[model samples]
Target: MARRRQAARAAPEPIRATSMWRVDQVFLTRKGQRVEVICSLVNDRSGLRNLSVIAPTEDPREAVRHAARFIAGKGNVSTARNARVRWTREQSTTLQDELVRDEQLEDDFQDEFEDMLAAVRDQMR
Candidate 1:
């Protein structure tokens, strides 16, 4: 007697949420002799609706880059496919005030950023 064979099953694909990000404003604030760069990021797809990056740098470009990297490194990729980066002259006082009030809750993610860079370097090698 011949035996019947079972068919192979395919694996299910992973669900990925693409994040759409908008960089609304990039402003500078001076504290004593040092200048701080603040960038506002808005994401409607994920829970990170409104996010801000405060970098103690004189260059606004650097601060914006940091914000992009932060979004990528922090798993905020749900709507990253359609990223809009625009500089607006108007600053958001509400966000700035919130940042100042919650200074203790601020996280730079420097170590995580470094690790991500290292991983990419390793992959290239």
Candidate 2:
């Protein structure tokens, strides 16, 4: 009975599938003629450290994808562990909007923006 109890106690507990990092916000910003996607992450373990990703693009979907990829690629090596992306409906809308009416000037410089995105992608790699 003692040996059985000791063996049972030594058994490992099942791991829970919980995200250690949460995506706090996903927003867009205008930089010169290009639109950039920014993602804010919070470490669930301590909720003190944060991570941010900035991807240059005209499309919000691409921005989210880039951010996700960056997180998957870097999250493990960093202080973050098992991080997952989470955002509200309003934040999702931000990713869906390709062109904000208020940023009319940004609409005029499409080619330049694409070039900038390409350069940023290259640098990221």
Candidate 3:
């Protein structure tokens, strides 16, 4: 009975996890001639966050404006439309490769933290 209870109390790890948004598309459009649009989303504790149609320009001022708008939802058409947008098939594969690299970095950080914790505990002992 105690064993079963212990197992039940143990938290289940995430089957899949990503710590950052995957860049869906990067576009330099004619309408926004000097601007490049970036689209991406991140899923975290707050829920899935959507960033759409960020218009970045080579000019410093425009780039700042674009970043602010992107963060503040000025160009989030998909979220307003109530859609879950996805990247192209090719982009998805590329994002998967990037995610693998990110996972390795995350693991490395976790290992470092564990070592630091062990050293602290040793000092306490």
Which numbered prediction scores highest in TM-score against the true structure?
2
Q: Which model, 1 or 3, shows the larger lDDT? A: 1
lDDT, candidate 3, 5-121, per-residue tens: 988896987765445332222222223345433344444333444443434455423433353345333322222112122223443457564333223323332343345445555
Weakest 10 consecutive residues of candidate 1 by summed lDDT: 101-110
For candidate 3, the lDDT comes to 0.38
Candidate 2 residue spans exceeding 4 A from truth: 1-19, 77-125
Q: Pick the candidate with the highest lDDT.
A: 2
Q: Supply candidate 3's per-residue lDDT for 16.
A: 59
lDDT winner between candidates 2 and 3: 2
RMSD of 3: 14.9
Off by over 4 Å in 1: 1-48, 89-125
- Residue lDDT tens for model 1, 32-89: 4444444455656433345555655655455545655665455433223223333333
All candidates: TM-score: 0.36, 0.38, 0.25
lDDT of 2 by residue, 1-125 (tens): 98888977766766656545544444555455444544455654545434455567755456555655565454332322222233334434676543333232223222333444455557779
Candidate 1 lDDT score relative to the true structure: 0.44
Worst 10 residues of 2 by lDDT: 102-111
